[model samples]
Target: MNGLFDALERAAGPVTFAPGATLLRGFALEDAAALLAAVDAIAAAAPMRHMVTPGGYTMSVATTSCGELGWTSDAQGYRYAACDPDTGLPWPAMPALFDTLARDAAAQAGFPGFQPDACLINRYAPGARLTLHQDRNERDFGAPIVSVSLGLPATFLFGGIKRTDPTLKLRLAHGDVVVWGGPARLRFHGVLPLAHGTHPVTGAYRINLTFRKAR
Candidate 1:
């Protein structure tokens, strides 16, 4: 894996990477602290946990949610549920700050009036990675996805509709926000295995907040 990213390009954009995808560099730095605090509170209410895929493998990332619905995966399959399977209660409400940031980020990315009903939080430690996959479980594909990165940096892979299509490996660091939708809604994406590192804000892990309109 040492030379995995050698052929890929690092993203330095506050620019559009695709027709409907925008990478806003440092867009969330201003709200970083507040967001982290909110994340802590949300996690306290509904602790993050590793989920099991239908195939029975445990995901490397720890996850939680704060919204009307939370995505869950298990022996049954992946689906959105109103309550946290671990807690047997509704997930914490999405914070106003999170809602506002999602809205503003979406608007800035040319997808105005975006109101996300779900915010999936993912925590990744060193060596943790997400494989290429599409977010197609949402009830509506008309809504865009807004993702915020915090803590240690990682390479984000954005690919075409098919998993075999060429992918772009973009360096997504603290406070970076990526919004994609429209014709790019079903594009495949994932995160490369995280490198070992420490960040002042997140210690040894990275936190990602992904907002989506699930309903």
Candidate 2:
């Protein structure tokens, strides 16, 4: 806890991308503990597992979700499902703290009236990397994507609209919240492979909570 607090105290201020993405550094500093507690409860209910992509490759990142709909992928491709495929039960409801944090983060990023119905929790261990890709599975494009980072530090790959376009590596630490919408909503983005390191709050793994309106 002390380590996390100290790190947050040293984090940089907000960063705004040209395409409308906003990174609110250390925005979740005070709420991180409660946020993590909520994550633990959600994981206990749904459990985290690596889902296979349509290409039949297993993702290195373990994932789970809470809220009205959950993002899922398999040989069939990516889609939003109302219930967890494993348990055939609805995923745990989104925690109130989680909801409030997301909404507040979005508002801070200039997207008011944000109401996310799906929160995807991704766990990344050392060497885990997510390929650059655009998020387009959701029904509404008007809503922005609010992502919260916790635990280990990560290099975020913020790319242009095209896959071949140039990308910028942004350092994201625990408590950093990034909100992207409008012109930046569909831009390609991903996380670089995590290096071997440990965080006080989450040990060696990093947890990312991505909230979206995925009706």
Candidate 3:
């Protein structure tokens, strides 16, 4: 048992099980205020909305995007596009701080040279939730997914390939960054309904920025 545990620990990838998928605490929050400011700016330009699913159901969480590509879902289906369908305009450009954080986080997780081209920003209010789903919209699964948590905390559900597979619930706090790729690239994941809370920075909301290589 010790040998097996050691082997798993020595695996050539990110593996920090804090009773959940993985937990890397206090990764970096130096520029969190700046990042949130940038988010507010983007939101002002392209307001976040509860996008409709292909099945016509409005999502519980409000979403916006930036970078070269943005993830969108509608009757056409979930996919990455160069512009926001709501407005015939390109999504906001990826902020330099975001790009730097993603690349640095990926490198820390053992996937270096990561250059993400899409960043999906999600805002979750009290009672908002995200259903379990795989992030397969990207053209390449080789690139890792870097998710940054800000404002109110959230419970993240990380599952395996099969939906029925048992999942680990992770408590993600503000300024936490979670990176997954390689064998965990296609893992199913989602967020449970957020509990009521008030954050000084976000004011009763949870903001998540997920960076991906959409091209």
Best by lDDT: 1
Residue 204, candidate 1: alpha-carbon lDDT: 96
Error of 3 at 86 (Å): 1.5
Each model's total of backbone clashes: 0, 0, 0
- Model 1 misplaced stretches (Cα beyond 4 Å): 1-13
Q: Using TM-score as the measure, what is the rank order of every candidate, best first? A: 1, 2, 3
Q: lDDT of candidate 1?
A: 0.93
Q: What is the C-alpha local distance difference test score of each model?
A: 0.93, 0.92, 0.85
Write down the TM-score of every candidate. 0.94, 0.94, 0.90
Candidate 3 structure, TM-score to reference: 0.90
Per-residue accuracy of model 1 over 106-133 as CA lDDT, tens digit each: 9999999999999999999999999999
Show pairs that collide, candidate 3.
none
Q: What tens digits encode model 3's per-residue C-alpha lDDT throughout 108-207?
A: 8778999999999999999999999999988888898999999999988888888888777777778888888888888899999999989988999999
lDDT of 1 at 75: 97
Candidate 2, 205: how far from true, in Å? 0.5
lDDT: worst 10-residue window of model 1 = 1-10
